[model samples]
Target: MIWNEHIECMDREQIEKLQSQRLCEMVERVYYNVPFYRKKMQVLGLEIGDIKGIEDLHKLPFTTKDDLRENYPFGMFAVPMSQVVRVHASSGTTGLPTVVGYTRNDLSNWSEIVARALYGAGVSKEDRIQNSYGYGLFTGGLGLHGGAEKVGATILPLSGGNTRKQIQSLVDFEPTAISCTPSYLLYLAETLKEEELLDKIKLRVAILGAEPWTENMRKEIEKQLNIKAIDIYGLSEIMGPGVSFECINQCGSHIAEDHFIPEIIDPKTLKPLPRGSEGELVFTTITKEALPLFRYRTKDLSSLIYETCECGRTSVRMTKITGRTDDMLIIRGVNVFPSQIESALLEIGETQPHYMIYVDRVNNLDTLEVWVEVDEKFFSDEIKQLEALTRKITKQIVNIIGISVKVKLVEPKTILRSEGKAKRVVDRRHI
Candidate 1:
């Protein structure tokens, strides 16, 4: 089921060699065409000739989201405006949205890589894909749409929201595959159960991404939907949702090394870590034309697995993302991540996957509260049973994160559901 087997299964030595060649050319392009990159290289005393291969990647200046923001729209584009064919942007919730462009070839390459991702997820031309990711400026929807088209699979670009229509299409279209955020999938599962349409649809494989989720969450989705849930990783700053994907083996996601180079570095020291060391994930676009970023810090935390996969792809695999350095929450002098809270909740097996973390300052002291959605069966339990459940969750959080958290066991559907990426954290302290 491997797509583009030649590139996916290329020898490790050959892959590195190809990456070196592409990296050298990309560095040259950015150095000459983009003034921003030229100034960066000059400031670092770096020259195009000095960047000979992948080994010199560390010597180049790192590109951060701030760099993209400073450039704003079209400033970071290496190619002329006439050559650019498409544009996409980040949500820019904190500030100005980071903009990205794509040439005809860049779009084509994106499709090919996305196709590779679908192939890795065991999707093929025979499968009908239901893409629930939102379409407009967000990259997830169109990104998966184009890739599914490239794979010759029939696609129903349902976009996002409209739960009634989504369920109707799932049953009417009878799509064999689905793609969307994991949280959205949970909402869809809930709707399906409400309407008793779970058995009416024929979804076999799910490509979930755009948010960090735990293994317990994945198992829950699979169990509820009766399908295999595969993780697909990407960001708008990079190429979107197909930068890497998990194969059927589910060991780790195989990175598309021929196009982008992956690296893990200590967030504070900014020094590259050895293979299998968990740290910040960084990327360098080797073949990108419109926007070629060098050592772009993704801010995601994950390790790399270089051993050959049983699935037979030599490309390096990235372990499931644990959390983001930027997403880390510091409360009462304790660092915590929403994913940690999620893992603890799902492990207990009594609560649903939907939960929210609220951090606030009370009496000049930081306080953490977790709102968990209890399973329907537990909602009718005795008051003492609910109290005991709350105590159990509080103990688990204390044991795992070393911080006492107030656990509120809310009834099912109490917490709002998201059709796009789930909003799991609300830190009122920032406000």
Candidate 2:
């Protein structure tokens, strides 16, 4: 099936008209088939007719992760189990994993959206993609796998882990693109550098996702790995990593608005913010059938712009995520977010990506500690060199986080292993 290039290049008025039409159809379908939407509409004294267009979307109640949790398992599913061809769940970080189901049609639509995202990222049939995102239960691996297949790219389904083995596969398969967490890509670069085989690997593009990273880190990864680093944004609840992706311009990720509607709202007030205003990102799935979400608050903080992209895609664009509202760690009455520390760490230019923020209370005072993993070149048996490095990192952390931190320089592999999202904060404080 061919995508509408015209829709992708549509002007503001044209995109809005198309979105309004899709939103109206989505509302009607959900109201009729999904119990959750019916209940929400009834409580809001809303009828299907009331939601005439996209403007009336504000009249509908917003959905959230908590709401998905409240109706655990298949409560939010619009279709029966027999119709659901696939099921995936969140990581259950907050509570029980919220399950999402997809019908065959939904699966097909998902593939199409993902394919468009890849195309927007400059991936084509000639490209070879090595999908390092973990497969099974997790949607990133399979979601992108299907998209790669749809685009007719040779897919190397090397789903995460075994650094040496991954490198071997790259050596043999010679994939042009890779997709995984940015930190893991750095891990691969480190492994390649250790084996002195960095020059042997051939990769043109990288699609990094599932965590918030800075532009500085992007340049660092690109420089070390010798590939164009791009950010792909999505959550399992919102239909995996292909929801949006960065184009060659790298300004912001372009949302597949034809399938999913994007909105930026004030995190606290839940009011929609104007374009270019930074706020929490929200999504409303317009094409999903089994579990169509309406105004689902993603809680991720970022800005959105509707201007035409240099890549010629008319989809609304979102800036790189600054920090998640939930991921913000309150340390010593000062708000500390991982992205801030990430930016600071990248600015330092000496430390690697493997660093942990340790927060503990000492004598009724908050004590912050940063544990940074030392590279092989920096590893020293001499105590003076180690102490100097530690002191330098400690002072930098204090300057950035506004709290003096004890910097612990650990061995190369002393830090904890992160199979999924990297753990940023290790807080023992009881709040």
Predictions in order: lDDT: 0.86, 0.79
Best candidate, lDDT: 1
TM-score of each: 0.78, 0.76
Choose the strongest candidate by TM-score: 1
RMSD of 1: 12.1
RMSD values, in order shown: 12.1, 11.7
lDDT of 1 by residue, 31-84 (tens): 998899899899988989998888888898888887887888889999899999
Q: Give the least accurate 10-residue stretch of model 2, judged by summed lDDT.
A: 328-337
List model 2 lDDT by residue over 1-431, tens digit each.
Answer: 22448767778787778888988988998988888779879998999889877888788889887788788888989888999999997533333556888899888877877787777667889999999987877788898898888888899999866677789988778888998777678778877788898778789989888666678768878899888998888777778877888887899998888778888899889899887899989898888888899998888888988877877777788988876778766443234566666666666677786888888755434577778888876778898988888887767656665645677877777888898988888877543
Q: Which stretches of candidate 1 lie over 4 Å from their true place?
A: 328-431
Q: Which regions of candidate 2 deviate over 4 angstroms?
A: 1-4, 328-431
